[model samples]
Target: MHGYTTDKDDYLKRLRRIEGQVRGIARMVDEDVYCIDVLTQIAAVTKALQAVSIGLVEDHLGHCVVDAARRDPDEGQAKVKEAADAIARLVRS
Candidate 1:
């Protein structure tokens, strides 16, 4: 666990937006919407999630990983490797 932090309000806003998108998707499903439209919304939600994940990863690297690297080279390297793995997974998805 890293001592990572972010603006609470911004995080909440993003979550709320994502929630709305999810609800919209549910509504589309209930209405038996077109296949393309449903798929587009699903893609939007996936992209949003990825965006959030990337932002957190960037923040962790900037703060936690940088701090750790300054204190211990090995720890910093480990953090970098972990972040790289996460990014690779994200890219694959």
Candidate 2:
């Protein structure tokens, strides 16, 4: 794969933070925290997750998909299209 290399440590750090956020949300629910506060945390988690997903997709396109296309035009095109569709879905979500 020719994609941009992601720092595994960095990704893991983000995931751990997200996990903590999730736990915090659970705690908030148990404590009966305000609805708005809970929702705000949820939004933060959502944005964090989206960032990770976008980073992964971008890396895939920069490395694996592009490399594949370079070696085989048809396969590369298919991969690119698939990536585009995934991006669209991500955006819609």
Please tell me which predicted candidate would have the highest lDDT against the true structure: 2
Listed per candidate, the RMSD to the true structure in angstroms reads 1.7, 1.7
lDDT of 1 by residue, 47-92 (tens): 9988888778878888888988999999999989988898899899
- Tell me how far the alpha carbon of residue 59 in candidate 2 is from the true structure, in angstroms, after superposition: 0.5
Residue-level lDDT of model 2, residues 1-93, one tens digit each, is: 235355567888999999999999999999999999999999999999999988889788878898889999999999989999999999999
Candidate 2: segments with Cα more than 4 A from true spot: 1-5
Worst 10 residues of 2 by lDDT: 1-10
lDDT of 1: 0.86
TM-scores of all candidate predictions against the true structure:
0.88, 0.89
- Candidate 2 TM-score to native: 0.89
lDDT for residue 16 in candidate 1, whole number 0-100: 94
User: What are the lDDT figures for the candidates, one per model?
Assistant: 0.86, 0.90
lDDT of 1 at 47: 91
